[model samples]
Target: MTEQLPLERLAYWLEKRPDAVWLTQPVNGRWHDFTWRQVDEQARRMASALQALGCQPGERVALLAKNCAEWFIADLAIMLAGLVSVPLYPLQSAESIAYVLRHSQCKAIFLGKLDQPEAFAAGIPPEVIRIALPYPTLAAQHDWASLLAAHAPLQVGHRQTPDELLSILYTSGTTGQPKGVMLSPRAFAFAASRSVVEMQISERDQYFSYLPLSHAAERFLVQMSSLYSAGRVAFVESLETFASDLKHVRPTVFFSVPRLWTRFQQGVLEQLPQARLQRLLRIPLLGRLVAKQVRKGLGLDRARILISGAAAIPRGLLDWYQGIGLTLCEGYGMTENFAYGTFNRPGQVCFGSVGRPMPENQVRIATSGEILFRSPCLMLGYYLEPEKTSQTLVDGWLHTGDKGEIDAAGYLRITGRVKDIFKTSKGKYVAPAPIEGEIAKNLWVEQVCLMGSNLDQPLALIELSPVAREQAPARVADDLEQTRQQLNAQLQPHERISHFVLVREAWTVDNGCMTPTMKIRRNVLEARFVDELAKLDAAQPLHWQ
Candidate 1:
């Protein structure tokens, strides 16, 4: 058996299944496949190019690209050359990109397809070499093809230790400025091995890579796991074609965020009228047959495991998926720990909990209910932020900033962020995440943000589903009112949403209302909708005093 680390695993794949297809991409509407041998060769060439550019060991090389085969090639090259890889989300603004590049002191950057290169050009220093990816342009300052052609084949060695830094992932910075979470090679390997064990990922499994590689959860689970298990990974061409690409790949193992899963549910529910669906599901034999067909049509027929992480998944969505014979297991982790802190096993899964901690890690709920973790997978510390690092990691335990309770069965149910729990002026403490999760269960409501910081009562900002608007524009208001009434009946007077503002536009990363992981940025959302929320406060309620 091969050693359980990145470079060792890569060598194992190179020797064992050199001709096995490792990665596939759609370019100009055609599929391009790469074997393990081809991947290793390309990575070696890129490693040589990095060395030729005077990239010393431990230096950070940044890759700002959408999910592509070359992204993995570049990542492997960085590891092979004994350097650290820093992946950035392709959708991030030029300013955020510049901040990460400068903060990490990245020597070389691989810029992917961008809408505005001039914006990036203006922000980055002239000395920093910006290499455009496979599809080169005359406008690009440094051509990646020419650089690779001039470089010799890199010499591979076993110089990297488990403790050596492998990656520095920047958090989404929902609360404040993003911190660089430094993860070692061993940490990445441990997380990957544990995930494979828990989720039962194998070499025969196929994964559809769509999530942002910058995010640790996706990187460790999908990207690193590919290397460990020698699994094949397919990249979607664009966000617009994700559904089509998913059908094409028919991935055996998949992972997605909660928002996408909710959208999937909305899509299904929208196709059938609620009255018709309720009646149809009441039939025993026909309902089972219809559901089986629905699951197959949705390209989930082959999926053995579907994982959701990076945020809390609403229990309602979980049950809805379960009804359709799909198991959407939720996991929990952060950049500081390289993902896979806890995950629901294949057979032993729960609805709202993020399962138990992986075998390699130890987790404990603090006296105040904060989640604290200790593991070899834990990062060394934040890069260049010693003070913040000291505060976050004390006595070898990572203060996750999340409040949760561990059940008798060891499943971890995350309630809310410690800082996000707000107190109403009426002296009631409210955890908005659970409340928002409950409100989002309504199929018509796509996204909900609950806010009541020092206010008399809680209020919610809701984004309606596309189907809700197209099918019943006039009914949108009525449906929202009904939803509010239903939710209010379930909550105490202070915890109920006294009022809500209907936002037609979706909250997305581009709009700065959500993080890259699709978690709501409470500060930004509150600021943007302050006026609308204030207007709601002044309005009269139908039932409330």
Candidate 2:
């Protein structure tokens, strides 16, 4: 049963629990529920409409939307229509949107909630059919209501073979051009079902969907996992209502990135200062009560498992969550492997490690210190780029560009990216991630990027957290310098940071300094700060932009 494809699993749920509420969505502060039967009918209707639009079985269908109930329905409809899915990040630049639409040669697109629809609408080719979801969106030839009313529910849906193409998820474009990663039904089925078993997921679990569904991590973790486990999924209405919606859902299985987790922590500290909270937490009886109250307030009181991924989380942040009775299991994976690699199991978590490989996953270190993985869930190849595909997938092993070290206990610790490692003027190699992690332990810092390819010493570009921005400038600077000195004491002479350059603006997806997944774009930052870096003196400990 676990080996069945997601659509087959959806069918199983439709038969067993037709009336069960599988999706809950908040719109205009009102709750809208969709049962398994309704989900099936809607998906079928959309599938019929898509087929009616002259979409070939193997033709590409792009999904451009924020995380919503309709996003899931559209993706499933594409699968049911036998069309390959190509998801675009809703927050991506218009140029990126145009590039993906043109590169993938999508015949149609399903548009949903977007921040800048007008700015991006021109990216869609005129020939492509536009189907808009039930949201205030750009002008489209077909709308959700019209499509459902016009087409009957598809009686005979396309049954995907094990190795048939499922999706082409583009990379986050941290380095340069986002390569389209080709995935199949076999890849998702093996990874999601096995992950369900490993994580002990069940129908009773609840998932809060906020992350972009385009990313392989969120798609596999939230979307596919919910399909396999038959879990109820909920979507946030908007950023303004995120807090209220989160409280309303109270999801049992929550997956979040480091930046959001840090934001949550900062929100708590704003209401109740850390010093006061820490003092209360020291008391035996009062501590548990306070912790429980804090969890309840954060809407994580019902969470059975909390996962942190996408990037390395600061250890101090994890410890702070632990103090509040929330244990975050840090996992490691890549889009190429369907986000299945290593994950810290419940009750057996090792600090600073991503845990052991999955039961069926083969992991080894290359002589070049790169992490290599061969798993059933590995991607087929990159779309239309045979040379890049060959370079990535060699001899059945997925060459994960991450440098990692495995402990004697089998815990995998990601050291740095093989490409991200840089050399100083003296030709000494430096891995920035570990040093960035150390600098991130300070609550004042939000995002940090270390780059000094040809400089005498490496310097860090720091983005101050909201809390730090609100604090006294003198205090924040003094505290940051203290942290920098302590961090340098633990590092080798050449690896030590010469100066901490503070950026005035936050590195957001909109600003193009961060990816949609909240990872700092190193290349973008390096190029953006070339002029500033040249002016920085070695004697200066802190340079504010």
Candidate 3:
């Protein structure tokens, strides 16, 4: 089970757990369950249709869809047809999607639940075939059920070898144009198997998949891991129904990003004032009742393991969740290696660290402080970028490009990105991550970005959370200032923030503040605020307007 490709593993479940539910999708506000046999049959039929359309082995097909049951079916169908799958982030802009389509030479697309049809449609050439998924927003040339009805299940006589190319996952670009990461079946399988062992995932565990399936974290952690463990995957339809979906699924193993985790923490705080909640938790019998109710309300009482990744989660956020009995273990991984290098495992956990390398992986810290690992899970190389690939993979070690420090106990604490370490005008270096993490403790501050290019000291630009957004401007200013002064008191002289400035506009993916994977676009933010941030250093920490 630990050594097989995903398609082979799926075949096993189809035979053994044919009656058990494998994928659940939310259709028209109603939950629909699909058995393993149903999923397999659909995928096999899709494979036959794809082959009939003349999609050749090793050719790339793009998947432009949100997280749904059909997304898995289409993905498996691609592999079953001996073709490579190239997933496009549903939120990707027309230009970006167009670049990917051209770059990957993808001749076909599976469109499903597109939020913006015009933008997605801009990428496709007139000649490329559009295969509709169950809930497609894009006008398509073909339908999902039609394909299954028209074609019989395709039969491939042999199992896909480990060295066979499985998919080319494009990196979630937080900085530049996304690069296609080439991975073999063995690479993804190794990662999924390692994650299963580390997380102790099993057949009975339930998985909630809401994060974009195209992202490596969700693809490997929730999707591929479910395939390997034979866990049931429940999909969320949209943001409005996240709570309802979670309540319905009550997933055993939950994986999420920091942004969503922060939102959950905020939701808890809204229900019970932080001080009152703490006071209540200290009372023995009442504390137990409070904890149970709180967990139940948040739909996490059934969750045995909760993992957060994509970016460093604030330690304060972790403590807040743990206070209410949800332990969020941070995970570390990347597109190049399927994001399975390290994880803060249960019982042997360090709060701020992403834990040690998995049992099957080896991590080494280079003299430059870059975290390096040589794993079977590492991708073959970046697609069509030989020079960049050579630069990243040197002497058999994959340079993670992330600076890290390993504790004496072997826990790995990511410091920041190598490119994120910037020198101030004072000629002192500052890493914004630790400083931002500390300041993120402030309840009023939803997010913070630190910048100090050519400035004597760094300045913090803060975005208020929804609760704080509703506050009077004066109150918001005072609270932000207090938080700034308190954080400054705890920092090194050079690292201390000189001033805090309220960001006038909220940063969002559409506004270029966020990447598709929900990571802050640091470079983009810094560029947008360079002059403004520099001007703020001479002024008071807050501006009411």
Candidate 4:
């Protein structure tokens, strides 16, 4: 069953349940439902339109959009047209966007919703054809409505073979240029099919897709998973309507990044103070009722499995969700592996660990402590970069740059990135990830990065949460000093935090401090604060920027 391509799976649904609704999209505050037949027809029409525009087989076509019904259809259309899909994050900087487009040599691009069209507009090369989706977007040579109307449904769409290249997904890295991960149809099929089975997803399962579909995690979990399982997918229209849309869908499966999960917790705490909430949870009957109310309020009432990934989440955050009767599972994967590394199964979850490896996915730790993975869904290689590819994929094993440890129970706990570990002036090395995770448990901290490098002891740079920012400076400082002292008690003498610097600005994708997927660009942050760190006195326990 895993051997079948995604398009073949789509075709199966089209034949077996043509009338079943596959996608629910919100347009202009109105919900729009598209059945399997409608999705197939639109994809076929777009496939023909791509051919009409002189796009050739085996060529690359880009899709720049948020998660929407059109984004899914355009992906299928790219596959049907015998073109490799190259998806670009809508929030990517112009330089990064230009680099990907030039590197991928995309023949055409399909534009959809973009928050900053002006910034992205500068990135597109004039030679590349632009086809705008049926939404308000940047100017394009062709529009979706006209093309679908003009072209007939492609009857003999390209049939993809198992090993045929399906997409080139660029990783949103913390440092250097983004590298394109080459994936085949078989990779997506294997990962998605296996994932659905592992999670017990079925035709009745529903997915809420708000994350950028360009990323491998969202592409696999929401789009490809739905295709393989014949499940329904609903999309959030915009940030303003996200809550209402999610409540309306009440999806069975939900996935989110760590930053958003933190924000969600912050939102909850804003309404009900953490102390009061904890007190309520201590009650028997009232605790259960409050938990149910909290789940319903967050629009996760029906979610059978809630997944958190893309970055390390604070264990305290996971426990907080558990207190509310939601098992927020953590998974570990990368773009090269189709996001199918390890998953915390529903009943057998292990906090602080990313859970055991999925069936057939071999995982081991190298002598240097880097996690090594060999899976059926692994990427072919990095696109057009044999040197990097050779370094990453060696001896049939994908060398994950992350350092991790597997317990006796087979659950994997990511320690830190091999490159991210920094040595202090005393020559003692410290893994910042675990330390950062510990600091994140503090309610005041919205984001935190621990860096010492050549210093005697590391200093923590923290971005204060909204609630923390509103509090009196003395109160915030007192709380942070307490957290820092508590954290230092658990660390080695050389690993102790020298000081805490509260940053004035929030780290965001727009400012380039964070990747589109919400992972902090550690290198960027470290460089940005070099002068600031130089001014900090080692004796001071805390400093506000």
Candidate 5:
């Protein structure tokens, strides 16, 4: 029978698989495991601690951390106490954190290993209780260990219904200020179960938790999926050590965003020279042997499913992975729908399409061609933003601000974000994402941002791979000219890039060009390069060299 929600599902698992491993964390070069029984016990203790601190039912408790065992403990405790969990991305700035804290009115917060706790301390008011996760060099404040040791596990009698608010996930704020997306326990449970069904996840599956749990896609897909299926979640120590950690875990199911996938693909390609690699891959026998070695080296030999979402996966990258014997499935969804709406099924995977809509979800294109969806997993509304909520959810359908077309076989191909489409001086509308996706498929190109807001045609700012920069310096101008010609040949005249600028530096989250999930903030990049693009457009053959 289907469980009502994650908390209920966890309770069921506690009864059936009390001794089974629920969470695994790597500490001091050792793997530590937590059983279902331990999870339940610790969560109860945390819930009691919150109760002891005067946290009432339905009150908000924020979690500010990376992927860790304590993160789940805090989340389950909040739910067990019938309180709402508010997740904050660990990399969020001080201002962003302060805004979320004040907006959500979170009474208590569990802080994780932060690079700058002083920033956090300054942002949050002193009256709000702060519980720091077990980390080194913590300031003299509310310690998590002391709270857990002092308080006894309260009896979990305050039960929450299926429709009760479980979580408040703030958007990444790529487009605007972050707004809290409130989700019911029922909505999260449905999304998790649907993901399990569509992805064919099982209790035996092992997931590597690396993505920020604050993001809806990772929170529901990894955290909630583990609770629903009684699977094991392995939390990596740090982002720098993810590859080494993956080698140790050998997870069966792995989910990553497009940027990580691109890096992984590049790593594989870097192992071999172009001519020799092409030749070896052509021979059937040697190609199979090389493929096995590559997969093993990447620690993906045991990977049953490699899923990419949260941003668009370049079709060429998808095809390249497929050619290398890895079935990388791309999915499409938004925070409003609990992070899943359409996914590519395992055996029926398509390259460019986001595949068929999952069970219990209806997807249709509006007259204006925006993709509209109706799903059981749909979120209730934005927290305290009734006008915006009404604008998004109307007539029982969620207006996904994505422009797309459904194929005859029911595969949804996302063309671009509705707001991202720009009209040129000739009044021809251009969807830059698709063209950028195509350009990014080239091994040399690391990142591409297309722009032409009020111009006659599109212009592109590109970041090149290190190898590409090193090897082609002498022939840089010739190579770029050839690449531009090839790209323009594949595009309509108006949509073609009239000028190209080679951005020498890499776009990164720390640099503010990319989001934490590695999505390029188009508005920021456009604003930064406005002058350079204008200069390029006026110049003859734009030469960064």
Candidate 6:
């Protein structure tokens, strides 16, 4: 049977596995393990403390943290105490965090390590009590040790009902203000259960938790998946130590966003030139040896499954990994659907496809060419936005704003978002994602944004890799020109890139060019290039150099 309620699933392990290792955290180059029994007792104590504070059932309790063992513990504690978990993205702006807090009306919050504590510090009001995780901040009124000691263990006799609110997940807005999506206990239960059926996630699996759990993908697929499957989880200490963390844990299952996957590829290319690496991988018997060493070097040698999602991964990058024995199955879903829509399965992997619809989940192409899906994992609704919810959740079908198509093999290929389609002066709509994906495949290109928007034709705004930047400007320009020519040859006149403008600045979350999840803010990119795009020639520029 599929494990649904997190606390119930966790309790089973506590009773059955007792001494089994459940979670591991890295601290100061040392690893700490939490047994199933230990986690149960700690979470029960935390639940007792929350209840003792007079927190009522279904009250919103915010959790502000990065990926850690305590993050999951706190999540279970909140749920066991019959409260709703409101996840706060650690990298969000102070204004956005503040807005979510006030909007959710959370009476209490648990704080953890954050990159920008000061940015969101002022958002927490005086009345809202704060409990610190392992990493205490100035905003924390009470620490983890104090809370655990202050109260006895809670005896949560009953599991949450399916209809009860499990979490209030706020969108990582790429377009406008973030809105909260109320996910019911049923939604999570269905998603986890389906994950077990579709992906064959078992108790023996090991997971490396790196991405911020605030995102639905990580929340459902990694954190909750680990809970439901009784799998062991290892948390990354920091980006500087990610390499060592991966090696130390040597996870059997891994998931990454497109940007990070690309970064990994770039890292390898930096150590061994792409041309030489490609040549080495083609040396017959030596190729197998080379591939094995490369996979081991990247700490993915033991991985039974590797997933890529959130945004479109460059096909060439995915193919390269496949060539080296690591086949990345692209998964597709949004916050509205619990990231359980389509996932390319093991052994039956479809190249460049997000794979088939999950069991019990129905997927169809709407008349507008949008991907529509209805499943048990579909969200309850947008929190306090009934009209907006009615619009999106029409007739029990979630109208995904994503543009996708169903192939003959039943795999789904996502093209782009509905709002992302831009039209040029010629009145032809250009899907920037496919174009961006093509340019991003180049080893030298770090980031690429396709822009046109009322211009005569589209232009590719490219940021070269650090190694590419280290090369002489003439060489860099020559390489870019060659890349541009190659891309334009495959595109129609309207979709062709007019020029490649080298961006001197890096796009980051702090700079408002990237979301907390590392997804590019296209509006921000377009805003930065509006003036430059206007100055470009009408025809495709032959002189990129």
| Number of backbone-clashing residue pairs for each candidate, in the order shown | 0, 0, 1, 0, 0, 0
What TM-score would candidate 1 get against the native? Answer: 0.94
TM-score of each: 0.94, 0.99, 0.97, 0.99, 0.96, 0.96
TM-score of 4: 0.99
Minimal lDDT window, size 10, model 3: 536-545
Per residue, candidate 1 scores C-alpha lDDT tens digits across 1-545 of: 22467888888888999999999999877999999998888888888888888889989899877788988988988888888888887667778878888899999888775545555665565667777788632155666678778876687643668887788999988977789999888888887876676666788999999888889988888899888887899998876777778888989988999888877776677676666766776699988887777677677878988899988877878887887789987889988988858988778897778998888689999998999999888888999999999999999999999999999999999988899999998999999888888877777777888898877898888887777767655566676678788988998888988886677678998889988788889999888876665555456442121
Candidate 6 residue spans exceeding 4 A from truth? 1-3, 537-545
For 266-310, candidate 3 gives per-residue lDDT tens digits of 788788988899999999999989999999988899998888998
Model 6 lDDT on a 0 to 1 scale: 0.85
RMSD of 6: 1.9
Candidate 2 local lDDT, 341-371, one digit each (tens): 9999879899899888986999999999999
lDDT score of residue 336 within candidate 1: 91
Candidate 4 C-alpha error for residue 171, in Å = 0.8
Q: For model 6, which pairs clash?
A: none
- Higher-scoring candidate on TM-score, 1 or 3: 3
lDDT of 2: 0.92
Candidate 5, residue 238: lDDT = 75
Off-target runs (Cα >4 Å) in candidate 2 are: none
User: What TM-score would candidate 5 get against the native?
Assistant: 0.96
Q: lDDT tens string, model 6, 167-279? A: 99999888688879889877887888778657788888999999989999998888878777878899999889999889878889999998889788878878888789889
Instruction: Give stretches of model 1 more than 4 Å off.
Output: 1-3, 115-119, 136-138, 270-278, 537-539, 542-545
Residue 410 in model 2: shift from native, Å? 0.9
Q: What are the Cα lDDT values of the candidates?
A: 0.82, 0.92, 0.86, 0.92, 0.83, 0.85
lDDT of 5 at 183: 92
